[model samples]
Structure formats: structure tokens, C-alpha cells
Target: MGDNEAPARRVVADYARPNAANARSSITRPAIGVNRLQIPPQIITMVTNTIQFHGLPSEDPNVHLSRFSAICDTFQEQGVTEDACKLRLFPFSLADRAHAWLESLPAGSITTWAGMKEKFLDKYFPPSKIARLRSMIQEFRQKPHVGGDAEAEPGDNEAASRDPGSADTVTDSVHDQRGGTTSGEPVAILGA
Candidate 1:
């Protein structure tokens, strides 16, 4: 009785990576799961179509930041919610890119959040609500000032909550600093 044989067990659920035994199963993983939808129906949240538009190819090898900026601009142009941009920045590189782009915007470009938001919503959004999208985006991008790719991730939910779909991302998809869904695979949604 000193050493008794025990049956080995393995958890078959939540199999993200491929399993040799289940080679025929093709249930792909989702970026965001339904269980994570913290907000209920009727709760106001920004649309997270951050990738709504794409920019032209960059000839420079260091265009990672620039590309990310281009993606952010896409959200602005397509009337997409800034929440998507904020969520996309959670992985750091995009946020850094966003920060760079925002910083580069002409100084005083957003002199008054209230006023600029009025204009932003006037054209992009309706009902005269969500008057802080522009500033919120600016703040998200401005967080990683000068800390582009050299810092450890603080793992803040700021990006996740704003753009839940973007948290835990693996793509530098915009610039691909990390990669894209090919990278780590995010787990939030609606720009969280």
C-alpha cells in the first residue's frame, strides 16, 4: 500500500491550443467571450470598430507607431467609438503609438474637451451624448509617453474596460509590433 497506482486525468474543456487527440474538432476560440459582457442591455458603451479603417503601407521599418496611429485615425474618421481605440491600446505598443500620435497633434488641438467633444459628436455621434470620446482617446494614447516598447506591462484594465476586446491582445496588427490575432489572442469585446 506504500505506493498505489492512481488514474491520470486531464481537463478536456477550454482547450485553446491544438490537441492531437481532437485534431478533427475545429472549434476556434473567440476574442471575447459572452460571459465577460459585464454590462447589461441598454448600458451605453462605445463601439469598438477600431480596425474600421486601415492606412496605406508604410515604407519605413519603424512605422509601427505610425501604423498604430493610422489605425486610431481610422476610428476617428469612420465614426467608430473611441472606446475601441482605448481597448486596442491595452497591449502597450498601440497605446504608445496612440500616445505618439496624440502628442504629435498640433498643441491645443483639444483645448476644451467639452467643446471639441461637441464637434466630434456633432458629426460622428448623435443625441448629443458621450461628449468625452475625444478626450478619453487622447488620455488613453497619452499614458505611455516615451515608454514605447521597453517597459513591462502593468496589466491595467484601463484598455480592457474601455475596449475589452483589446485587452490581452497579441497583434501589432496596426503596426504589428507584437503580431495580431497571430500573437496572443485578446479575450474582451465591444472594445471593452
Candidate 2:
């Protein structure tokens, strides 16, 4: 009855725990399931990389990727130019892990974007970046003793500067669907 005191709260009687009732719990993703939509002709081939995305909140990887592509298209249409749209571009697993890690941290502690990145790195990133670091390393496992191996020529840089469409480096994975495996992922990753 004092000003400093608060009334006692009680749990609702209807609430029931599944474990107590001998019931099972499961997770689901409705967005990834069968939906009426055309498969995208364009696919992003991440060579020598692994992207961990949050697949639980999302169901279809293709659908999520399409949304990311749409955001890119919107930015291009608005005449705003930049590199890859890092905002929407996240690895499925990394996103989920980052989300969980952030939730674990005390509120307001994640004050800056860099803080989030640091925590994300501390939680998920390996000695190197990306989900498939081992595969990326293996991609370069062969002969490469030269200093200028990774560097490109001036003309090659100009060619690389062109808009992303059917680049030779990534073309094989994107268009290989004709001979590519349609059984698993729509976009088959290379070196990952």
C-alpha cells in the first residue's frame, strides 16, 4: 500500500509449458516453403567464400537473396552507387549467431555499428573471415609463389570495374544451371 511498493503479479492460468504436458517443440519457416513465384535467372556465385545467413527467420534462401537483389536494384534505380549492399548481404548462419550474441549483451551496450561488428567477430568469425575459410584457403592451395599473383593488370582492373552481370570469374556458377545441379541449392557455391 506504500508509494514505493508495487502490486504482486500473477501468471495467467491458461499458460502451459509443452515439456510439462509431454509435448514436443519445433521451429518453422513459412517464407521458405512452397510459394508461387518464378525462380530468378540471375544467381550470385560467391567464389572462395562462405556466407552464414539467418535461415530460421527466413525459409527460402532464394527468396531472401532475391530481396537483397531487389534492394540493390532499388538503389541503382535511385542513382545511388556503391559497392555491394552490405546491409542486406549477410551469411545465414552469421546473421543468426550475431542476433543471438547481440541479444545476450546488455541493452544499450551496442552503441555503435563497430561495436556490433566486434561482438559478431568475437562470437562467430574464425582466424579469418567468412563461413568457409578452409575452402577459401584450399582454393589457393595450389601453385602461387609469385608476388603479383593476386594483383590484376591495369586493363584487367578496367574490365573488372564494369557493372556486375556475367563476369568470367563468377559466370560459371550463375549460368551453369543448365549443366549445374538443380537438386540442391539454386546457386551452387565455388571453393566454399
Candidate 3:
């Protein structure tokens, strides 16, 4: 045969020839049991670094809520389940009065993070109070002081000129209850 034509048959078979030793056995293997395919329970590693917070009287609900959110975030980043999140929260909850309040609830009341968060907000930051505070802050305006001897006092200007770097020499525009502009430091409104 020509070099291009080659041989019609290969010198050796491409596949192995079957033999008694390699032949399929007549004995049938037993069927696999369902248990073999069943998945095993996953083992979850508990969180090691627990979050710390001061007890209630000192720590407000807002502060606890923020810390709680941070703890939840940490659990989520670790691929922990909601149940694990609740479990992780247990230690910190017992640490603070605010947290303890939630912990004191009936068993199963806060099985999930959502439920826990709801209870926490309801107890600490009531909707009515939050709304009222928000509205009051939004409506709040500084009142400007009307003309007075205090305004005419050149002593303030003289002091400012005397010591430009002095903090006491600073003059800030303040609004009074009358909504008039006055030259003075702004007064801080407590618990507003």
C-alpha cells in the first residue's frame, strides 16, 4: 500500500480485548441504601468572640441596638444561621439591663433576629416618642435676640480685638425664643 493509503487494519487493536478475568461478573451488587445518599447533619462552630456591652441604666437602647446590629453583621459574615445569631446574642443580652429585658421575654418570643430587633425597638425607642422628637427637631428654630444693652456693649468687640486667638472673644450668631438674631454663643438645648 502507498504511504498515504497506509494499512487497512491497525497493527494492534485500539481497545483491550475482553478476557474471563476482566469480563462483567454475573453476581449482581446489592442496591445502594437510602442512608448512603442521605446528607449528614452539618456541625456549626459557635461564635468565639462574643460582643460586650454595659448593662441598661448606663447604655441606652439606641446604643445596644447599634451594637446588636454589629454583632448580627459579624454572624452573617461568618455564614451563621438566624438560630446561631440568636444564640450568639444570648450572652450580650444577659450583660445589659436593656438586653436582659428582651431576654426576659417568654421563650420562643424572639426566635429570629427580626423578632428580637422588633421587640428591642418597641421597648427602647417607641414609635410615638421617636416621631414626636423628629417633628420637634425639624420645627426647631433659633430665636434671635432683639436690640439690648448686651448688643450695644463694645466690650465684646474690644476683647475680640485685644486677643484674636482667644476662644472667649468668639462671637456666634444666636437665635432666641423670639426668632431674632443676636450676636452671642448659641445655647445648647438639652434633651431636645
Candidate 4:
């Protein structure tokens, strides 16, 4: 190769290309069945109105996921799978920081509804948060009732025991980090 022509060589540093973020989606779309399935605008609007997660510290990601799943359950198309419906409508429920977090995920990383749920919970409801909640549950103690009569009558106690939904009893909705309630039973406390 002549020096004047410059030997054909590989360029080590290539010029920057256009950003592809806008062109690609983080969540993978399900394969279209025999008939193409589409979520209705009304369903999207309903989910948006009912659930909004901003990724705030106060927001419970589990609760948000549960609620979102519930809303997604309301509508079902013949060709659409449950996860397909969830994956489609889940994005509309996110706002502010939550939406940003979703956008930050790598393109095509989430292929299934399970993957999306896992990623969301791993980000928002981290292990540290779960530990903290678990610790709180372990350290929970009922505070003595004030202002009201400290001691209830024997008859009142009997009535409260018979009625599972009595005001005298308090039930803790301590969510198990892995799934549903830690224990589905109510923690009974007698007023004293």
C-alpha cells in the first residue's frame, strides 16, 4: 500500500451515532397471536386514574403492584394472555420517578410479566426496605388504649371475641415481602 494513499486500516475511534433509546422499548412485547390484541383506551385510562406510583419512600411498591394487577384483571380480551394485559397497561400506572425508573431499564431486558414485576419490586421495594418492614413487625407492640375505658366489661370481652370484626380488636396488615400477608390471622389485643 502506498503511503500517499494511506493503508486501508480499521478506525479505532468511531464517531458517535444517534441515540437509540427513543426507538427501543425496555419491556419485550408478547408475540401476536392469530388475531392481534390491543388494549382499549378506556382500560388504560381506568388504570391511570386508579393507580399512580411516583417511586416515593412512602409508597408501597407491593401495594401498587397488587392494585395494578387487580385493575388489569378487570378486562380480558379473547386473544390476550393475563400477563400480556398486565405488561401493556402497567406502564400507564407509573408517573414521575416511577416512570423514569422504568425508562432506565435496558432495552428488551424484561420479556415477561414476571420479569417486569421482579424488576419493579427490586428497584422500589428493595431488600433493605423489606428488612426494615420485617424488623418493624418483629418489634411491634400494641399501645394501651387511652381516654376510653381501660378495662372492658366481661360481657364486652365475650362479645368482642365472638365478633371477629369487632372494633375492640386490631388486625395488622403486615405484608410478607415475598408475597401476601405474613399471617392471615388478626392479632387480638384486649383493651386494658
Best by lDDT: 4
- lDDT comparing candidate 3 with the true structure: 0.48
Per-model TM against the reference: 0.16, 0.26, 0.42, 0.63
Q: Who is ahead in lDDT, 3 or 4?
A: 4
Candidate 1 per-residue C-alpha lDDT over 106-176 given as tens digits, one digit per residue, 9 for 90 to 100: 53344332333343334334443344656666677545523234343555323323543664432222324
Superposed model 4: Cα runs more than 4 Å off: 1-22, 142-192
Lowest lDDT 10-residue stretch of candidate 2: 24-33
Q: Alpha-carbon error at 167 in model 2, in Å?
A: 29
Quality of model 4 by C-alpha lDDT: 0.75
Per-residue lDDT of model 2, residues 27-109, tens digit only: 11122222332222232333112333453533444454445445435433122222212322332223554445544566445
Which residue pairs in model 3 clash with each other? 56-97, 143-175, 143-176, 143-179, 144-176, 144-179, 144-180, 144-181
Q: Rank the candidates by lDDT, best first.
A: 4, 3, 2, 1
Candidate 2 C-alpha RMSD relative to the actual structure: 18.8
Model 2 CA lDDT for position 18: 41
Q: Pairs clashing in candidate 4?
A: none
What lDDT score belongs to each candidate, Candidate 1 first? 0.36, 0.40, 0.48, 0.75
Backbone clashes in candidate 4 total 0
Local error of candidate 2 at 89, Å? 13
lDDT of 1: 0.36
The better candidate by TM-score, 2 or 3, is: 3
